[model samples]
Target: MKIGVYSYFIKNQARIFTALVLTGILSVSSGLTLIKDARAASANLSLETSSDVSKDNTKSNRLPRPVANAVLQDLASREGISTRELKITNYNQQTWSNGCLELPQPDEACTEALVSGWRVVVSNGRENWIYHTDSNGRSLRLASANTPSNQLPTSIKNAVLQAASKRLQQPISQLTIVESQQQTWRNGCLELANPDEFCTQALVPGWRVVVSGRQQTLVYHTNQTGSVVRLNQKPNQSTLTPVTIPVSELPPPLDRDVVFRQISSGGFAGTTYETVLLRNGQLIRVRIGDANDSERSVRRVSVQQVRQFLRSLERYKFTQFRNLSYPAPGGAADYITYTLTSQKNTVQYNDISQNNLPSNLQVVVKAWNQITASAQ
Candidate 1:
């Protein structure tokens, strides 16, 4: 009896399935031979059935086949699992953003914005892994699913927060727990290190807790039992000392003893406005138009507020901002320049956003803007 083409195709598919089942034990060459044979059989079926084979060809061509294969093989080897045990759940071409990397110390070269890359999500039944790769399929990093804080037991959360508070040397009420998540901990080990011996066995499970203080945000890493393993260093508080500035750098036409000149520029083509804060808490606002046309308004700001602004200026080390610049995006940039002067020193810095500014400086800028807007 002659076997029908459909029957032969079904039998061939069963054989390919069995070959896949045995892939864990099969040699790489043997596995490839089986795959090649399966493809040849599929091609033969299309020829006999008069069906369009171009669809099959195009489907195979759409993905970066070699890259995908290499990723599967590498992941399986690292995980000590069969390739068949891993399933590719999702994949897409991605453009790298500023925070695309989640590694402890990401490659500096890969941090460029708008770079082309690929993100592949794979799973092995119980856990999911995400692989980030460059356009050339070079693996940049691997991240696993994080257990959300809400899902964690309340005791675990409390323990972690307590540990964080102890590390920060602050009371629990003073520190705010920003976030917590369960993640695989490498304990600062290399990604390519032996997973079984170093990373997985050494630090299999961990939690990352983030807390915010008055001066900075701190990240803490802890084990499953909520014991602190590591924490990031605090911001450089030693540099917060006061700075002296010369009186000559103040904008002209003001009193010869003016100590601070805050020139703010905004609107299209950069309109100018200025605020002069003297040493005795007196403030003068000047609005300038083209050709040096100007109007001045005067007010006595509270000594407390003046002290706060001065303290912020010193804390943020604004004097260090001289010659620092940020390119403004077209039609959307506003510039703020703070020039502080005393009898012996002068410093000026300009930027478009408060993100680069210290928290105290940010508050000072907001207050200055309010005062300027009122004068307008």
Candidate 2:
């Protein structure tokens, strides 16, 4: 009886130990399931919470409101969530369609506006509005225009942007300004890949200092001296300034009746001058003379300027010159073409085109040595 009781106690203890081990395995499996479920739920919530502005079609529904909302509802149902949270607060989305937006509210830092057709979105930061277009104005990822004010000297930025814009045939509207920093002119010079001499020559005409953003995109214009300017890619340089010359300083039209006095020792001596003595329509005293002329008359005047003096003369007159061939100096089988202006006996031989002549023919000037004499 004593041996049987001891064996029964040992058997009971073994059974109890086995039961505890099984319970622990079941508990671990249950905890794993709970953890997986919680993670799955969190992932679903995150996916549904993202904004409907994705450009990728796989991520969200098409635009134009009703469709987007329907797609949102479908997504919510699949995730076992209520549609109430998915309701778009601002479906008007005028800011998303047109590139127009008011200044950011007190708490907000920046406002984004979508530029139609470009897929480009512009963000208006504290100081300036940045564009989302790429170097060529093709649609590109949205980016900011912020540069620490101290980084690039405003001068470097301005020059690079203006040069790039002119080179790329792109409007400032399409450039995305990424990073801008202060840089010395020497450090920022770009080595052009194609080396277009004509385009490069225009890089900094007249003393223009350019302010550019990170991509060397032009943002503003200034003079070489670094005065703030307001020119926006104007080909004509005159339009950039503010000073308007009043008409008071202009010289009055020369009076045909008043004989002009000649200074004996001036730059005008000995030269024949054509002046508008009585320019009542192209009829000027065609025989005006400089101070040195044996016959002294009025001093020489520009034909165009004279027309400007008397507008009526412009209609009656036109410029004419004569092109003719002349004998060559060397007497070889060669001749030169000369152009004689209507008023002057002087002949000018153009030297530029002689190289392009055929091998059999050579070009030379006949009376070129006598140009000064001809004028006399």
Candidate 3:
């Protein structure tokens, strides 16, 4: 009986041990699951913190409400879209080289002054637009405007717009700048001269501006400045051999640096006067007998100043005067006879009421006077 009791007690002890072991195994498994859940929660918290930090940084980089709205409103107006669709993506302070933000329209004069401004980038997710603005957003300019393939400079496009408006007798608002192609026109008339017109056969760098309006597509050819625009249309029963001024007849030294000399004689004094202009902006004058005329008084101008003068020569089509002689009116022999020489050709003209000088010659005469006065 006592042995039976000992065996039963031993069996009970074994069952208790099993139950404790099972309990320990279940406790370990639950602890491991709790640890995994805690680690996952920690990772989630870390991810949330990182996301919050990124959002904070992005917000910090955002622009002020007014400045942002200014660009957005402008672009929205241009695109005919909602302001909410526009987003300001980036911006920074910049000092522009000139009042035109370093993007001057061809021949559009920009004030030579530094401007403190901001360059803001706006976007519609797929495409981006750039803008330049003063600090307070009082003055703003769109640097990246509408153009698909070949883009004309802003000024050139505006010029074409104006010209097309006049040619079509339509308002500017109805016109659209569609396309541009760089072209080298074969003549001064941009190859659009009338049958009876004569064109200078010089290579003219220009553009073909395409516009769409009133259910009609119009093509216009223009010089770089859009200063010369011609419409392409059906010929008006006109056909003829084109007359051209040969390139050889084109004028001088606006394309290169060279010397220009002028000799004056046959005035009342009958003394010879010679003036020399060097590309370096030096002007020297000499006379045959008069000490005042013979003594060299030099006035030096900047290279840019001289280049501007040369541009005037080109702008006035001074080449037309090449090798041409304009004599004093029949009886005005005492007038000063002036001879101007360039590397390519010589031109002579005299001062007499009856001598009809081409208006452009006055541009050169004015320049000569300015230098000669400083020399005197």
Candidate 4:
């Protein structure tokens, strides 16, 4: 849908991403336990440095430069502001069914053939605007929002980011926002007051922000203005509003050539996301646990590459992780527990021990992360 004037027709694959998920809250319980500790996360300093530089470039990446520049100039001209004052929050590639990009002007005649273009979401940190354009943006159209939405929703997004940056003691540029959901808490503690902490006994409207850093992810809860921010360390659910937004399940594989499947959940929001990779190198992702997730994404890679990966799994004795439930240690909170499924064998682990996981499990996580990044 559009943000300001016009809209692009979205495809079905775009709908595949918003689906179901869940979690297992295993602590010091009297049950089967297989706890794993995390190793330090590795990083390529050069890549990280270069990546940050691109954000400042403000001229490329997912949104083509021509389209982005055109959208910027048009919005700036219309709003009577500088192009620098505008930002593009989102952009997605699209294949329109008609020359009009599926949005024709009143009584206008248009060609009836498929066309490739983009649906761009631009904002001035106030109202969001959507612009549709051809591949190179030689043609453009602006449409109003389908359901009007504030670009930053009262700037709470920034407030929570700052809070999380302070909490992690990391540079703000190094952090990524995974998700933000509007919520009403049962208490003033944002439903995460510790046993020893004091909290007001009344409902409070706020937001749940999921922030991701190089080695960790966390939840920051805040009021409308983000003036009262809290780390959600102990989520209290009894009186809290059910924050789960119902989503569809991932579509089944075309065949039974399954390689492995992974399901992850647990943040302050306590929602699940899933992914699956087939032997033919068809990777499908749904309800991803990362920032700015789409409904779903699918990518096809070299079958030889997938075969090589399976061989690597064999080298690591993949079956050794079967039925292993890598337990979460005591006092762990906001950790995303990951479960791996292959054939009849199932293994579970969590973000707490992601980097230090068993080689068999580690390979799967690392490979899938890479695949997901490339798909993005």
Off by over 4 Å in 2: 51-376
Best by lDDT: 3
lDDT of every model, 2 decimals: 0.55, 0.33, 0.68, 0.65
The estimated TM-scores of all candidates read 0.28, 0.20, 0.32, 0.30
Which residue ranges in model 3 land beyond 4 Å of their true spot? 1-258, 288-294, 353-355, 374-376
Candidate closer to the true structure by lDDT (higher is better), 2 or 4: 4
> After superposing candidate 1, which stretches have Cα over 4 Å from the reference?
1-256, 288-294, 320-323, 329-352, 356-360, 367-376
1 or 2: which has the higher TM-score?
1
Q: Candidate 2 — worst ten consecutive residues by lDDT sum?
A: 313-322
Residue 340 lDDT in model 3? 77
Per-model root-mean-square deviation over C-alphas: 25.1, 26.9, 19.0, 37.1
Best by TM-score: 3
**lDDT of candidate 1 over 158-188, digit per residue (tens):** 7756766777677777665544556676554
For candidate 3, write residues 240-345 as lDDT tens digits: 1111223464334422444567887887778887777767777766776775653755667665455556545545545445455554434556788777775545
Encode model 2's per-residue lDDT on 176-256: one tens digit a residue: 333222222211122122233332323332233333322332333333334323334432232111111123522233343
